[model samples]
Target: MKEYKLSGWPELPASYQRTAYQRMLHQMSQGFVPLGQLLRVSGLGRDAVRRFLAYLQASGVLVEREHAQTPRTLLVMDWIRRTLGGTGPRRQA
Candidate 1:
């Protein structure tokens, strides 16, 4: 099988391209890194990350839960994760 490499980055929707979304995905994959650390890992501006997270919430891809005084984003990656059943139906617009 030919090994396929991505050309640049995936052209995600504007909602997904937000820094916050990027940071959230990165943290979910890499595990609980601090904001500063996430910034270093994501290579995006602080403000941009904030906006990305907002988009993720709006898209219903993530949910926020309050703990004490702070809110933490809960990953809903399972919506995309394959299950024991057959492949899920595509989302409708």
Candidate 2:
């Protein structure tokens, strides 16, 4: 299975209105994520997340682990985890 991470936030097109995509954007923004976990975390089903992943890849924000050459990014991700207390997916009332 391939793993991926965001190089940076991708700009959403005007047509993107799915809340699932929004949730996914937040999750992917966190750190490196494997495709399986991305689907699991988003709770938005496999097909939808896969499509979104493709879009992000095309938009150049999605970086495959093979291309993620920065160790500093890992360090920053760790800092974010510690500081944010693992703020994973959630829902609001």
Best by lDDT: 2
Candidate 1 lDDT for residue 86: 42
How far is each candidate from the true structure, as Cα RMSD in Å? 17.7, 12.3
List of clashing residue pairs for candidate 1:
19-49, 20-49
Residue 83 in model 1: lDDT = 44
- Per-residue CA lDDT of model 1 for 1-93, tens digit only, reads 111111222336855656655555756443333556545667878797566555544555443432222333222333444343446654669
Q: Tell me the TM-score of model 1.
A: 0.39
| TM-score for each of the candidates | 0.39, 0.59
Worst 10 residues of 1 by lDDT: 1-10
lDDT of 2 at 31: 76
What's the CA error at residue 8 for candidate 1, in Å? Answer: 23
| 13-68 per-residue lDDT for model 2 (tens digits) | 86556676776677667877777777776677788788888888899889777435
